[model samples]
Target: MEYGNPDFVKYAEAYGAFGHRVESAEGLAPLLEHGIKTPGVHVIDCPVDYSENDRILNQAFLRAFGSRRQAMQKVLFKPATGHGPDA
Candidate 1:
């Protein structure tokens, strides 16, 4: 029920104000309301599960969006070097 990043709330809201898409897990639904479809973000109702360690990383999360937006719906995770941060 509590977000790890307190700043995310204010930051997300600010982005919403600027017409930037906003989405979150089901729990965050309480935070983003009143403007479900008014040029705003889409709050996904999926929980983050690191259980997919063999698949996702922090950067994977960032890349997925751009990939989806730029015609590459498939978010390839290259944890080797060609992708994500130097983790």
Candidate 2:
């Protein structure tokens, strides 16, 4: 595992780029607001934890669908009773 800034902020500095480091969700709003308020190109360094990716994605999907989990499941996966495309 290489140890360094994954967002490569140093490179941005070398190129005179505008950026903000977002260490947590709390920093996101300010960064977003800054991007919206400012006119120049901006970079937001927001690293995410991929370990809980499944749970995070599932929760997001559930929230978006709003209690249509079963319907989403049917659309995402076919029946295993050998009555679909595989059959």
Please provide TM-scores, in order, for all candidate models, with all chains considered together: 0.21, 0.49
Give Cα distance to truth, residue 7, candidate 1, Å.
5.0
Error of 2 at 8 (Å): 2.9
True-structure lDDT of candidate 2: 0.74
After superposing candidate 2 on the true structure, give the runs of residues whose Cα lies further than 4 Å from its correct spot: 1-5, 54-87
Enumerate residue pairs that collide in model 2: none
**Tens-digit lDDT string for candidate 1 (1-87):** 765534444565666642223355554555456446445564333335567784565447556555444423344443355666654
TM-score of 1: 0.21
What is the per-residue lDDT of model 2 for residues 1-87, given as tens digits with 9 covering 90 to 100? Answer: 878556655556667777677899987998899889988767777777787988887787777766556648765775568677778
* Candidate 1 lDDT score relative to the true structure: 0.48
Name the runs in model 1 displaced over 4 angstroms: 1-7, 15-36, 40-47, 52-87
